[model samples]
Target chain A: MKEFELIRKYFSERGPKRKDVVLGVGDDAALTRVPQDKLLVVATDTMVENTHFFPDASPRSIGHRCLAVNLSDFAAMGAEPAWASVAITLPTSDEKWVEEFSNGLFEVAEYFNVQIIGGDTTQGPLTVTVCLKGFVPENKALIRSGAKSGDWIYVTGSLGDSALTVASKLNKINVKAEHLEQAQRKFNYPVARLAAGQVLRHAATSAIDISDGLIQDLSHILNASNVSAEIDVANLPISQAVLDSLDEDSAIEMALIGGEDYELLFTVPEEQKGYLEQNATAMGVPFTCIGQVRGGDSGICLVKSGQKYPLPNLNGYQHFSSEEN
Target chain B: MKEFELIRKYFSERGPKRKDVVLGVGDDAALTRVPQDKLLVVATDTMVENTHFFPDASPRSIGHRCLAVNLSDFAAMGAEPAWASVAITLPTSDEKWVEEFSNGLFEVAEYFNVQIIGGDTTQGPLTVTVCLKGFVPENKALIRSGAKSGDWIYVTGSLGDSALTVASKLNKINVKAEHLEQAQRKFNYPVARLAAGQVLRHAATSAIDISDGLIQDLSHILNASNVSAEIDVANLPISQAVLDSLDEDSAIEMALIGGEDYELLFTVPEEQKGYLEQNATAMGVPFTCIGQVRGGDSGICLVKSGQKYPLPNLNGYQHFSSEEN
Candidate 1:
């Protein structure tokens, strides 16, 4: 089938229906309405073959993960996911591949009520770059630069499962088949903490989505807000899949440096911690307080027992700079 | 240099200044404020080596062409270009290539006051996908579906220059060195007809950017509005370079179906033709009326010397569909 035909057949009508989309696909561009008093939050992420996923990875996973990562950015900002446009480069004309890819993409998009408003398609190596537009009410958007001294750092959901799957794929770790599969699910389909993000919009002082490793991404908040952090290593959220597979130290390392978790790392005033924890439990989002903001030059340190340890590495998945990913 | 270093060192802090960007680059995303009463107009285009440009094409030209093509979409909609996000894939981390590419991209962007808000860089086959966000006053965006019967069809600038360059490069046409260079300039650095589009916002009934040849793109407007067109081939704005390089017949055919000119193809109500014509000249944008919209089923035909002719193929450089370009 022709590429345009394939696009209309597979991608054009998928995702949640939208009201503010004045014009959708098939036009030269998409026209959408921006509501008054709401600020638009835009984020884009590119996933390339091998660099971001495996060649044999399910096309559905590829589609899901590409859009999923971008949605996580909106989640970090406490924004409502609205619309998206994708530019997909495919090496060959593969009908089934595009079908499954669109299905996967729309599945996640529909889950968040996001509409796929427009896109561009080209022939090349498989790569998907997606840009999402969301909205936050005026003066209510969460930002990384709002953390201050006396704020308590917290993270939603357990970390390291996604990175554990990568280790399993590379044979760097040994685990039971079922356990590895569970971790793989987390790796392939990690959910963005949108509910937690919204709840934290007013409760949290600052926030960032952990695509980079936890400590490394937390440093961004510290730097942006001109504050420091002392994270209690023992308080880190350790998933059962990770704990049952690896020893404490390995699990901790993976939790610290494991990337692609899509979890929300946030800070709240110490006074709000009491209600924030209760509210998170009520909302069914796991919340763990793992650190405290400190008054000082911007930096991050780990607290183990009573001793402060310097960070191992502050960079995560930086292209060409570090080979960690 | 690694990809991240290349992005920060070369592509960062370029382009025209934009004050609406609350957060630009360096983070997981970019945040920009859209004015209260304006609708967001967005378009995305992807350029892949061997598919959209030659592998040996100048990095500068390649950069300029990718963004220029996207801006053409904004021009088609009569929107104000505001910001852009790029997902660039390079075969390797070449500092010089990145430098030249940034120079070309920023040159066009700054001219239109479009800011580089955020982007991703990675190792892969060379591909550039850019998404532009623009603004249009509510209810004022020009669309392809607004042309009515009796509207005069017009196009800005000459056609087939870029395609002529392609023909020259492929040895399909022979031209003097100066003519070939002039054609190459058109091919490499075609300008988006923004000024004309803005002047036509209220004057023109419908509009589209001619990236994929005149006939192929005009068909979009015709199909969208459920109308047909009678374009006079003799009236097409054929450049002297194209005429000198090819026979008159071949030049007309190229103008009919050759792609990637980056000009505006629009329609004006007969009543407003007087205002549109005078305003276009005042805006320093060439306007040529070549046809008229007619009441009929969606289709297009060409006329030369008062004789109706069958339309040539109307498909543009569609991926895996047309081999015209």
Candidate 2:
């Protein structure tokens, strides 16, 4: 099929229909109406073949993962995802692959009420770039720079499962057969904590999504807020699947430095802690208090059983680095 | 260098800064404010190595072209280009290349008053996708579906320059040295008819930017508006450089079917012709009337000296087709 037909059949005809979209796929540009008195939030993310996913990865997972990563960013900011523009570059035009890929993409879009407004499909190595546009009420956005001293830091859901899956795939670790399925599911279909972010926006002082592991993403909040944090190593939320697959130390390391965790990491001031506790059920995920924000320069201190825990040698994922996936 | 550092050095610290941007670059997502009573217009375009440009093409031109294509879409919509989110995938972090590439990107951004609000830098084969967001007054956007029968078809500036350059490079045509330099310049730097689009908004019933040749893009307008068109082959605004190098037949062919023109093709109704003519100088480029819209099923006819002009066998570019760049 031609590029125009492929796009029309796969993308333009498939995604969630939105009322605010004045014009959608078949135009020079997509025209949308921003709700009155709402601030517009924008996020862009790219997933490349080899670096971000295996060449043999499922098309559905690839499509889901690309949009999920960008949604994760919006979740951190307490924004409501409204529309997306996807640009996909592929080596070949496989009809089945495009069908399954659009299915996965539209599944997520429908669930999140996001409209696939416009997109561009081209010929090249496999790469997917999603640019998401959303909205937030004025002064209600959760920013990385808003954490305050004495705030209790919390993370949504368990960690290390996705990282453990990746480690196992790389042969750096081994997983038991019983836990492999759950771990693979965690890695392939990360659920963005959008509901939790919206709930946290009312109480959390600041928030960030865990894409580059706990430590690295937390460091962004710390650096932006000019504060430090002390995380209790024993209190880390390591999933049962991850714990069953590796030793305690290895699991902790993966939880700390292993990337692709699409969970939310947030901080709550002392006054809002009770409010968060009361409304925690509305967050739509299991919550855990892992640490406390400290005054002073940016850094993270790990505490294990009353003593300072030594930092591990593992590094968070970074694109263009020698150790990239 | 790390992905974050590279992005900070090349993209975050550069580009035009606008007052509407509440947050930019560093955070997981960007926050921006939309002016009251304005609607948001979005356009996305991607350029990949080998498919869109040669591997040895200058990074500067690649950067400029990637953003310019998107800007051209906004120009066609008669929208004011404001913010852009760029997603770039690269094989390696060549600092010099990045510096020059950002230079070209920022050069266009600054000239057009567009803010580089956020971006993603990933590792892969070179690909750049730009999603641009701008604003158009409510109900003021020039849409392809608005054309009416008897509307005069017009195009901004000259055509066939870029395609002629590509043809010469592919050894499909020969050009004199005098014309070669001018053709290369036209191919490298396409000036999106932004001012013309905005000026034509009041006068034009419909508009589209010619990317995949004049015929293919005009067909889009015809299909959308449920109209047909009749082009006067002798009246096409072919550039002197193109005519100087090729025979009249070949030059007309190039003008009709050559892609990557980036010029605006629009329709002005009989009632608006006086308005368009009065405001022509303010459009920032010369325009020529070459055809007229007709009431019928979608199709295009060509005429020369009141006789039918034969349609050529040449096809416009399409991804995944056998005849691709």
Candidate 3:
């Protein structure tokens, strides 16, 4: 079978039925009606082999991660994800790989209440691109330009474990079996903090998803909002699994500079801090106040103990880094 | 710099200013407010290296083709394209490639009056995925399933030239240089029939863009509309350039099975055919009647010398054909 026929036969099976979708795949274009009271929030993310994932990574994990990362984008914007279009390119049309990949993708999508509305499948080196279409009330989305001076910065969940898992997988680092599994799962199935984001809309002045390391990703909000931040090094959230596998210093470094955590990071005004703490407690999710937004300087700073120290030069994952070569 | 920083520095430049674009790139997700009175149409297409284009094709052409194909999908639906998001994956972050690609993408976007709303960039083998969001009046859009028996099938411009261009390029066939240039241009930069599609909304009963060759793509309408078609083989609009490059039989075959023409193939009611022809002529484009829809075996057939015959087994372009190996 040719590529189009293969797609029509195998990949063009019935997607999740939804009232929002007027038309699905196999047509010239998909048609969906957005509710009148909602604004559409759109985000796209692409993952490549060897750079975003190991060549040996299962197709199921790749598919899951592809949708997961796009969902993270929706989470950052405080949007309720509704529909997604996926474009998959492969070195060849390996039926086994495509079957597993689609299964994994649909599995994750089902949990998030998202449906595969449309997509394209083609031949090329393995790549997955997902464009998520979500909805939020008009003028209620969290943006990266709203942070103000005196707001408290918060991060949901722990960070840096995903980066450590990458290193362990690549450098063959030995660690406790339980720690390894937790790290691997964190790397593969990082949850998007959609509930926290939606809840924080009224409180968060600015928000961003932690795809890059905390320091680098937080810099995006600072640059966009024209504010500086002072993070308490002692308050950085490091998971027990990561802390057990690596020394305290290493865990701190990873927590500060590791990327791909997919956690929600935001700044809430001082008046809203109480509301946030209560909400986090009700949800049973950790929301640590790790930093404070400040005027002037316009960058991130780390305060260790009573002394302020300049951070080391550590750029997060560049696509063409010499270290990778 | 990391992939995120590079994207912010280069690809995050402002897009065309549009009132509909509530938020653009540089944010976690782009928020757009669709006009309350209009319906949104979404389409996505992915182009892969060596599959969608020549290995040596410039990044500019790749970007242009990527957006153009998605726009063609919008054209088929008679939708007014408003915004697009592009997800690009590259093996390495070459600054020159990014510059050219963005330039080519925005050039077409400007021509079509669409805004580059948002997208993602990552490290991977070269692949470009574009998702377009367009709008039309509620329940006033054209679709493939609206064709009825007795509708006259029509196509815009000529066909079969793109396939010939591909063959010529691959085999290094030395035909007339002008003919080859015309053919190659049609293959690379075929225009989507946006104007024709929009104007024909009232006249066209069913429509589709000819990306998968005329016979095969038209089969989609037949299958969806539950009708058969009788196409006069002699009436196919074959350009002189394409005719000169091959014998009459081969030219007919090319027109029937050649893909990537990107022209509009549509059906009009008998009463509206005259209006369509007059409108097309006023627009300075050719609209040729090639067939008539009928209720029969629900398949396409060809009429040669007043005798009906089943078309040959020349399927349209399939991406995963074993013959490629």
- Residue-wise C-alpha lDDT for candidate 3, range A1-325, written one tens digit per residue: 4565666654566446678777777678877888998888899888888878989998889888999988888888888998888888887778788778887787888888787877888777888888889799988999999999999999999987788898788774556888889888989877778888888887799888888778877887898899999999888888877788888777788888788888888999999988887787543467889989999855888887867856756743433421100
* TM-score, cand. 1: 0.94
Please provide, for model 1 over B52-131, each residue's C-alpha lDDT reduced to its tens digit, 9 standing for 90 to 100: 88777999998898889989898888888999987887777788998999888988998889988887776778888888
Return the DockQ of model 2. 0.55
Q: Encode model 3's per-residue lDDT on B223-264: one tens digit a residue.
A: 889999999989999867779988887888888888888888
Full-model lDDT, candidate 2: 0.87
* Local error of candidate 1 at residue A115 (angstroms): 1.0
- CA shift of A313, model 1, Å: 5.6
Per-residue lDDT, model 2, residue B170, is 90
Better of 2 and 3 by DockQ: 2
The better candidate by DockQ, 1 or 3, is: 3
Clashing pairs in 2: none
Residue A172 miss distance in model 3 (angstroms): 5.2
Ranking by DockQ: 2, 3, 1
Model 2: runs farther than 4 Å from truth? A315-317, A321-325, B320-325
Best by lDDT: 2
- Candidate 3 DockQ vs. native: 0.51
What are the clashing pairs of model 3? A3-B318, A3-B319, A3-B320, A90-A124, A318-B2
**lDDT (C-alpha, whole model) for all candidates:** 0.82, 0.87, 0.80
Q: Tell me the TM-score of chain B in each candidate.
A: 0.95, 0.96, 0.93
